[model samples]
Target: MPHADTLTVVHHDDTKTRYTDVRYQLIRDGIRIWSREGEHSLTDILMTHAYRRREQKH
Candidate 1:
């Protein structure tokens, strides 16, 4: 399983219809950690994890 602190989130919007569908994905080291389809806000996704780590400068 992907480490909670190392996961990065990506948001995508599907506008194939009148309404927009949002997709949220958490990825770690080029691997998909989690994915879901819905109308979730970025703040909602960030708040789900309490121990998120900052991206390291490499």
Candidate 2:
């Protein structure tokens, strides 16, 4: 499980279309800490998390 304050990935779409882009949002403490739009795979969420985790050490 993820810590409520440190990790979360919201996979959602903003539009209805054949090419509708998905969004990956990194949330912490009820606010968005990072976001990426126009991705094709839900896997982007995990990739974002991995990347963010490294940066969080700073």
Per-candidate TM-scores read 0.17, 0.16
Candidate 1 off by > 4 Å:
14-58
For 1-58, candidate 2 gives per-residue lDDT tens digits of: 1222233344444322221222334344222332234233333232232222233554
Q: Can you tell me which runs of candidate 2 are displaced by over 4 Å?
A: 1-5, 13-58
Q: Of the candidates shown, which would achieve the greatest TM-score relative to the real structure?
A: 1
Which number leads on lDDT?
Answer: 1
RMSD of each: 12.4, 11.5
**Could you tell me which residue pairs clash in candidate 2?**
none
| lDDT score, candidate 1, position 4 | 47
> Which ten contiguous residues of candidate 1 have the minimum total lDDT?
14-23
Error of 2 at 13 (Å): 5.0
Model 1 C-alpha lDDT versus the unseen true structure: 0.33
